[model samples]
Target: MDIVFTVLILLLAVSVSGIAIRLLPFSLPLPLVQIAIGAFLAWPALGLHVTFDPDIFMMLFIPPLLFADGWRIPKREFYMARRSILMLALGLVFMTVLAVGYFVHALVPAISLPVAFALAAVLSPTDAVALSGIVGKGKIPGRLMHILEGEALMNDASGLVALKFAIAAAMTGVFSLRDASISFVIIALGGLLVGAAVSWLFSFASTHLLNLNEEGDPAPGVVMTLLIPFAAYLIAERFELSGILAAVAAGMMMNYTSVANAGPASTRIRAGTTWSMIEFVFNGMVFILLGLQFPHILGRALLDAHETSDVQVGLLIGYIAAVAVALYAMRFVWVWLLRWFASRGATKHGVANAVPGLRTATVTTVAGVRGAVTLAGVLSLPEVLKNGAPLPGRDLAIFIASGVILVSLLVAVVTLPFLLHGWRKHKDPHAAEETLARTMAAQAAIRAIDDVHETESADLDESAAAYAADVTARVMDLYRRRLASLDDEQESRDLARRAESLEFTMKLAAMRAERKTLLALRNSRTINDETLNKLMREVDLSETALTARRK
Candidate 1:
C-alpha cells in the first residue's frame, strides 16, 4: 500500500508540475519547477520522504529516456557530428577524470585519489536534457544542439564505465592502466553490438512471427517497444557490459529497423504517442526524485559539518564551488582546443571565421550541467571495503556531487538566457530541405492519385468514368495548390499560401461544428454514446491533422 501510494503521489506531482509552470507569470524551466515542487513536498510539515536507491533509479529511468533520445535525434546530424561528439564524450571525459580528479584531491587532501577520480568520472557526463529544459526547443543553433545531444547520448556510458573502474581500484587497492583500457573497449563494443542485435531480433520477430504488418491491434508491438530499452539494458549488464550504451545503441538501431520503417501507420502513431507520454512522465519523475533527495543530502551534510565547526560548512561549500569551477574550466579548455584544431583544418580548406568564439565556448562549458547520472554514480560508491571498514569521504563525496549538480543547474539557469537571447531569431538552416521534401511528397502524392484514378476508370461506364475523373481532379488539385505554394515565384507562392490558410480556417470550423453536433446528439439521446464517440473520434482526428499541417 505504501509503495502504491508513493507511486501515485509521484505521478500526481508530475502532472501538477506541468500545470504549475503554466500558471506562473514568469518563464521557468519545467525541470526547475518540478524540482521546486519536490523540495516543497519534502518539507518536514508535509512529511514526504522517499528512499533514494541508485541502482534502481538508474535501471528504471535512464534506459527509456536515453532510448527515446537516440530514436528521435536526427541520424544524419549525429553522423556528421560524430567526430566532435567522440571528442567531447570520450576525450573530454577522460581528460576531466584526470585533470579534475587531481584537482579535487589537491583541493581536499582528505579525499583519496581513487575516490576523487570516481567523483570526477561521475561529474563528466553532462545533462543535455537539463540543458534542453533550460533553453526551450529551437533556442540553440541546430548544429550545436545536435552535437551536444550526440555527446550526451554517448558520454553517460563512458562516464559510468570510468566510475566502475575507479570504484574497483578503490576497493582492491590495485589499478592496471592496460587491463582497464582493454576492458573499456570490450565493454563499449560488446554493449553496442548486443543492443543493435537485440533491436534487429525484435524487428524480425515483429514482422515475421508477430505479423505486425497486417491490419490488427498495434498495442502488443507498441508494448514491446517500451520493453526494448529495459531488455537491452538488462541483457548487456548480464554479460558484464555497458548497459547505458546498450540502451542508446538499441534506440539508434531503431532508425534502421523494419519495425520502425515498415510498421503500419496506426502502429507508428500509437507508438509515438506512447513513447512521448512515457518520456514526459519518466523525465518528470527523475527530476522530482532528485529534488526529493537534495534537501536531505544537502541539509544533513551541512548540519553535520556545522556541528563539527562553522568553518567546516564553508569548507564543504568551497569544495563544491572549486570542483564545479574545475569542471567548467577543464570543459572550456578541451572544447576550445577541439574547435581551434577544427578551425585550422577548415582554414586549410578555405573556410572563413572557423575559429572558436568565446561565447560559443562559454555556452558549451555552462551547458555541461550534471544530472541524475552523476548523482546516481556518486551515490553508488560502496560504503565498505575488503576489510569491512567504512569507505573514507563517501558522505563528503555525495554532498559535493549533489552540490555541484545544483550549482551547475543554477548557473545555467542564470546565464543561459542572457547568452541565448535573440538566438531563435536566426533563420532556420533546414528550411530549404523541408520545403524540398514537401514539394517532392506533394508531387508524388499527385502521381499516385492519378495512377489509381486511371486503374479505377479503365472499365467503367462513361458517366461513371466522368465522375471518377472529376473526383480525381478535385483530389489532385489539393496537391497542385500545395506545389504552387512551394514555387519559386513569390506572387504565386503568396497566393497559394493565402488560399491554403483560408481552406484551413474553413476546415477547422467545419470539424468543430461536427463535434458540436455529435455532442448534442449524445446529450439529446438522438444517438447512442458509442455512435457519438465513433463520429467524434473521426472529427478529432481530422482536426488534429488539419491543425498539424497548418503549424
Candidate 2:
C-alpha cells in the first residue's frame, strides 16, 4: 500500500476498534485489543510495520494528552489529595528507583547499575489514564482516584528527571548528587513558572483578541486553546526544564472557558469535543505504536541473550515478572509505612493520614501502571556510548521496560474488578445541593430580568411594561415550582426515589411545554425567524437540563 493509504488504514482500524470497545456491553481488559491488532500487523504477510521516532511521539502525543488530563482534574479534589499525591509522586518515586534499580541489577548481572536505575526510573511513573479502568465507577474511593491523578501529573517530571541523571551517569561515568539535586529543583520550579506565564498569555490573547463567543466563528479561540499545550511544552523544554510538568501545569491553570467569562456555550461545546477526539486518537496511537515495536524489541533482546548460556528467553520473561511484582510491592510497602506513621502520632504533626487503610493502599499499588512515558523514555536511550561502542543493555532496557508496562497493566486489569467488587460508595447528596444551586441561578436571572425592565422599560410605553411583568411572572412561577420540590422529599428513604422521579417528570413536562410554545409561535409566523431560532436554542438548553440525570 502507498504510505499515505497505509496511514489512513491504520487510523481507520484503530478508530473502528475504539468504536467496538464502546459499543460492546462487556469490554475486554484495557489495551488488550489494541495490542492484539498491533501484534497481528507484525505478521510477515502483512508487510507493514510501524517504526518509532521517540522525539516525534513524545512531542506530538504527550502534551495534548497530559494537558487534557490536567485540565479535567478538579482543582479542589487535587488540593484535598495533595498529601497522598506528593508521597507517591515524589517520595515513592525515589524509593522505587532505589529499590527497583538494585533489584534489576541483581536480576540481570550484565546490566549496569546506572542503566538499571534508568529502567527503574522509566517504569516508576504511573499513567493516570491507564488507571481509568481500575478507578471506574464507585469501585475506588474518589480521594484515592484524585490522588492518583495528581501523583501521575507530578511523577512524570520526577521520574524523567531521575532518568536524566541516570543516563548522564551511565554516559559520563560521573554521578554528582549535589549538581543533580540542584538542577532537578530548578528544572521543576522553572517549568511551573513558565507554564503559568504561558497559560496567562494564552488566556489574555483568547479573551481580548479572539473574543471566544465570536458567534460567527469560534475557531480562533479553539485554535488558541489547541496551541497552548504545545507552546507550553516547547517553552519548558527550551529552558531545559521538565516540559511534562510544565504542560500539566499549563493545563491545570487554564479555565477551559477562559476565552469568555461566560456564555459562548457553542465555544465550550466545540472545545470539549475537539479535545476529547484529540485525547482518544493520541492515546490509542501510543498503545498501538508501542505494540508494533514488540517484534523489534523481542528480536533484539533474544538475539543478544541467545549467545549467553545463562541469559535464556525464559529467564528474561521471569525477570520481567519479577520486576513487575517488585514495582508494586515497593509501592505497597510505602503506602503501608505512610498509613502506619499516620495512625501513630504522625497525624498530630500533619505529616500523615491516620485513616488511610488497606483499601487505599491496595488501590494505590495497583494504579501504578506504567504508560507511554515508560516506552518513550526507554526507546530514546542512546544507541552508542560516548566511546562509540554499542550501548550496554540498551535493547534489554526497552524489553524490560515494555514487559513491566504490559505486566503492570495486566496485573491491574485482572485484579481491579475483584478488588473493587466490595468497594462501594453511595450517590452524592445532589438533591439538596443541586436544588440550592438552581435556586441561586434562578434568583440571579430574576434580578437581571428586573434590571432590564427598569432600564429599558422606563422610557417605553405601558404595553411594554405589562409584557415585561408577564414574562417575569412566568419565569418566577417556574422558579417557584422548582423551589417547592426542594423541600418536598419524603422522610422515608425508600420513597425518595419515587418522589424524585415524579419531580423530574414534572420538570421534563414543563420543558416540553416551552418547546411546544416555541414551535407554535414559529408556525403562526408570530415570531421573526431569527427570534425563533434563538428562542428554540434556549428551549433546547432547558430541555437538556431536564433530561440530564445521574445514571
Q: What's the TM-score of every candidate structure?
A: 0.98, 0.86
Task: Give the number of the best model, judged by TM-score.
Answer: 1
The whole-model lDDT of each prediction reads 0.93, 0.80
* Lowest lDDT 10-residue stretch of candidate 1: 420-429
Q: For residues 1-551, could you state the per-residue lDDT of candidate 1 as single tens digits?
A: 88999899999999999998899999999999988888888888987899999999989999999999999999999999999999999999999999999998888878899999999999999998989999889888888999999999999999999999999999998999999999999999999998888899999999999999887999999999999999999999999999999999999999999889888977998899999999899999989999999999999889998999999999899999999989988999999999899999999999998888888888889888889999999999999888999888788899999999999999999999898875546688789999999999998999999999989999999999999999999999999999999999999999999999999989988989989988998999999989988898788878878888889
> Of the candidates shown, which would achieve the greatest lDDT relative to the real structure?
1
lDDT tens digits by residue: candidate 2, 390-452: 878887888989888888888888888787777666565345777678768767777776787
Give the runs in model 2 whose Cα sits over 4 Å from its true position.
1-3, 22-25, 134-138, 260-263, 299-311, 345-356, 426-435, 454-463, 488-551
TM-score of model 1 relative to the true fold?
0.98
